[model samples]
Target: MTDVMRCEAVADIATPIGHAGRVSSPVAEFDPKRVRRLRRYTWWSVVPMASFYAILVITGLVNGFADGTYAAADLLVLGLVLLVLTVEATRFCASTMRGLGQGRHHGAEQAAAFIAALLTAGCVLATKPEYGFIWVLLPAILAASIVTNATVSLRWPLTFATCGSTAFVVATASWRYGPPMVPIRFALIAAAVVAFTIFVLVVAVWFWDVVLELDRARSVSAELAIAQERLRFAAELHDVQGHHLQAIALKGELAERLVGADDGAARAQAAEVAELARTALRDTREIVHGYRRSDLATELDNAREILEAAGIATTVSGHARSVAPPLQPLFGALVREGATNVLRHSRALHCEMSILTDEHGSEVVLRNDGVYASDGTSGSGIDGLRERFATLGGQVRAEHRDGWFELVGRAEEPGRSEA
Candidate 1:
């Protein structure tokens, strides 16, 4: 009964929006971390009243059992009151934890409050001589109302019922076949009861309102983060494509004009168009990837060194330097991929790479002298390589034949017509 509300973090532990006031079970739809935290908050919330009630009952029980004037009958009455309390307390707890729903179930909350108040009054009245002043149970029951959401509507009937029940308990005790306690004692108990009921219910409902507000704040924060990302994407896109598109339009107009007048010059302008397209594609990729961080020569050198250290003789001959600047990443990927295959699917003594360039195209042939039947298909890296090379009229292929594994690839000159 000496417990005061330590509401420092009560709002933080109140039900969040997702599982607020509508879960079918205690263990359902609740975050384990949050649930654990809520459980503690709930303990703190109820212990003050519940623990105080327990001490009051025990005081009544012991005082009754000690006095010879009220041994057997008062013991049986208090025992019956305990049974009713056990059932009502369980109901009250379930209602409190789940959060009493709104108007849809207002009747249940009313019934609970009225019945609990009557039972609490009965416990005190049962030991009238021993249980003095604890008649405050009547008003306490009225004030300890619960709600799942922050909505309170005062009903005149419920107010009448609670007040009437308190009066009935005090009147019955005063008018009973004995010298009654003074009138001031009844007034004090009635005043304490009414004051606590109002205080407890108001504070309890306000805590949950704060919880609902916090949930809304979290939702706003997430939406703001998403808006910031979209703005960044838009700004980067404008910066990358603005000048490139203007240059592409000029080159296209030049090619169109030359097509009728000078065929050779038009062909040259078309090649410039292909180069411009490649540059735009690269710019877009860089924006998405955060920046172009790989160079084919560097990757090839790293791959060759890695494979050689693994006790495999590696001969890398791909002239990544000969490929157009935009396509170097694809050749670099081929070198890295060849090294990975040698290490993972083959116990190879030798790995060889041949970079061949001709008038039509550039090809990288990666061959290793070990064959292990494997489920490793062209995985994400190879699929990405295929897409990247396809943008510039190129492709990659793989084969296994007689203890030899070969991956061969080519990216044709950009302006070359596919035959």
Candidate 2:
């Protein structure tokens, strides 16, 4: 019964780990939309607020020293400070929303920040009427926001729109208030267009890379969850079914012997069989309720039982230690699968199971003295096993050589535990 329980436990542990192996690539699980939204918020809030504060401070210093617009500068400073506070508030709110997985509201927050920055630029233009060239800052901020929010290909067009707008506004302001030189005006516009375009592209690419990284992290988290679930189900099935099946088999044998020989004995055997069946039914119900996994030690014990049941002389040797609780299922599944393959495919008389911790990871190996087909051909089962191991960042090797078939797997130490 203990042996049966062990087999079940091993089975339970391996399921989720095997499943995780199937969906292991971090890239595959990334959500592009989430990354894009985060980029949009970060760029819109950080860049504009920083740029506005820098320009406001510089303009205020010039007015205080050279011109008697200190009062005007003071008002501008207050307004700009308020705008900075608004930007910070929006950033804080957006981060909170993101933490709660509310990505949809990110764009709205970004737009709000943009509007605040634009308002600050408007106030500056009104206060320092002579420094109207600073109005060019608004279009530059819009262009930077666009590049940060959108993809690389759209950057050029967004930059051009910003530069063209800035140039038109600055040119009109100059023509109205002061003398404008065609050569110098064109040169200034051209320089702003070129410089802002490069700036937008560089910042966009940087933010886009950040988005990709976030996507990768999200993908890995999803894969981990999936692997855990698979391990859990595997453990439950192994525990419930393993004991039930053995009990049924034992009772069935006893019933066969007692049949027709003695009525009382036969009736007793029948009762035993009935009880075993009921127990199995109840266990099945419990399994169906939910799947929970056992630790690695439990799984190793289970593997030994499973191999022994197959008439394979099995031995397990290792210091009893705990693995990450979530990973226990994965390791257990690998052992179960290895044992199953030995029983089902290989005509093996002897099997050996060993676990050891190395510098890199914990290694589990199963070896059988069996006659397997010489050709390297994998059926559905082998393919599935391969996929399972791959997801766990482990490798599986099966070789049939010199009347011995061996299967080996490794699992790395997890940084944290999962409940």
Candidate 3:
């Protein structure tokens, strides 16, 4: 349960909200995407780990064969231990590829591997005194594998196992060979082997984490990109609909007021309202056709019109056409979002916009002092705009202060990092 929860938490951090639930589950059925991701992860993580364990098994067997000190029974015993280790090592690899103890237990499996390690170490100790060091190498490698593959925390147990195995190997070497010389030489050997094994295992774990984190980061980037596209589309849609809807509402009301005064004037006003509606429909189609990403110059004009209709005093300065070509989309979205926010949220009748460009880059500041209900920050639109400008080393900030709300965004000049 803890492992499951832990994996889920990591997935949540790495995956996007829309796909978090489906992708986070280790127990999830294999789809093409999941399989592809897992395969890539395993290629780098599990394959190298398996190679490390294989080396131990092969080296241990070679040591046993080359040293002709064992009887037939002893040889059989060594072979039996080697067999157990080989199976367990292979099992470790399989389990890793499948998922870290998805349907099985982690601690128990690590314990079992630890015991196999101890058994291998013991066999090496009993066989040949001259080859006592080989025993430490095989078991230490196995210990490293156990440490790397564990799902649950095994820091304390792994510490005990390493310490115990090192001690036992040293003691066995002392008892087999001479006194001071044997113990001193073997203790140093055991300590070296144990330290190297722990280092390999720890580094393996660290590299594994890096791989997972990279994978998670990739997924998040892809999802965030999709989200930004959707938001830009929605914000554009809102701007289209809002601009026309406000026009229709204002013109229809005007026609209503003028109907009793003059038939000709009322008819003309109604005709203009009809023309605006048709223009809105055409604009919506053009927007859908991807005719333009953002039109800052046009949006600024529409903003002033909309705000004035809403009885809000508006002061707009700075020419959008003067902004660098690359920055049109960013400032375009900004103006559209700024207009929507001012007309919808502010209860006061004052707004000020200033678009400035200089050495640093382009900047847009939209401020309004009114009955500030919310922070007046752009929702998904902000994220989309931020992403666009960030490519050019830009940033965005929103502030509500002193009975006033402010949104300030700036993008740096490309290739001017030295400045």
Candidate 4:
């Protein structure tokens, strides 16, 4: 259950919502497009293993039928055994690819396949002892495939022992029933088949493991980036407020001391304290409102980066200098809010942003396609933006039309502010 939930969470982080683009979390910096590509690679990597398994299993069945020695009853029994083995092999491959547990039922299936392989090999040997060396490779390869995917605790030891035991058994049988050199030849061939099949299985599993590791690393890196950003913000806030707070404390102490000897001096000191407090309050508010770091160009670049990360094609145009210095921060806020809305409220695939300044005012227009059904409903973020823009005689408009959503914010020049 835990593994299933983890896979689902990774999928949520790496798969775009609605097959468009909707991020799981704004801070999770993953590209669903890249993840999807990796998924394709993982799928293709398993194809060779499945193909080889099928060919080997089919070869065993073909050789058994073409032997021309077995009676009808013997052939029928051989066919049934091979059929069971093929079905079990198919189930194991499907279960492994689908990430299903190799539980007791799987153990039972593996045992059954092992028994079927042994029975089929016995049938081949009993009918045509001379052909046993060639036909025995089939069961060896199949057992290797099953062992490679097994999750049993002692699987490695078990695999080595099983392969070694099979080689010895085949060699002993060959010696007992065939030419003297046949035992060594059959033993070497069995060992080689086991080794080659294990190699192929390991390579397939490695490719999938790499894909999963990449998926995990993507989420971890995103979380680390957010943590670093938060630390940086906290440090900046401390720098801004720490100095003013210390000075305010000293002034308050001095004012208390002066009150005993000189009322006028105490009053002036108190006034200084009040002014210091107000200055600190203003600086704190500026920090909170993003005035200290609200460069319109930076915000635009950030928006583009975020949208592209979410698999959205984003284009940001125009320069920060195009807007009046006083209105730059407002426009920056607009870009940030607009990009955030596109990520959180819509499944946008492409976004366009344009910032401009003219004789009349400064304006920014943001547009995106794949607007969600509820996109036009104003949220608290948009409401706050409207209030901020209104303070400078500006307005922000958001609307959805023709399957596109647009946000436009404009603030008039100081000359036209009163009018």
lDDT of each: 0.57, 0.54, 0.60, 0.65
Better of 2 and 3 by TM-score: 3
The TM-scores of all predictions, comma-separated, are 0.49, 0.40, 0.52, 0.69
Q: Which structure among the candidates has the greatest lDDT?
A: 4
Model 2 earns a TM-score of 0.40
Per-residue alpha-carbon lDDT of candidate 4 for residues 1-419, written as tens digits (9 for 90 to 100):
00111323433333211112333453333345565665576556543444555456456556656776555776576557656665665555544553312322456667666656655564566456745555454565556556656665656775776577667666766666667787778777776776676666556655656556655554353333334435656776899899999999999999999997998999999999999999999998776566785567766766665565455678777877888878877787788778778866776768999988887898999999967777336888888889999988889999887778999999986667558
Q: After superposition, how far is residue 245 of candidate 2 from its true place, in Å?
A: 6.3
When 2 and 4 are scored with TM-score, the better candidate is 4
lDDT string, candidate 3, 80-145, tens digits: 765666566556544544333231346676667666666666656655665545556546655655
Model 1 stretches astray by more than 4 angstroms: 1-42, 69-77, 90-106, 109-113, 119-129, 132-135, 147-150, 155-188, 201-205, 208-212, 215-223, 238-250, 292-419
Every candidate's CA RMSD: 17.4, 17.8, 17.9, 7.9
**Cα shift from native, residue 404, model 2 (Å):** 49
Error of 2 at 250 (Å): 12
Q: Where is model 3 poorest over a 10-residue stretch in terms of lDDT? A: 1-10
Best by TM-score: 4
| Model 2 global lDDT (CA atoms, 0 to 1) | 0.54
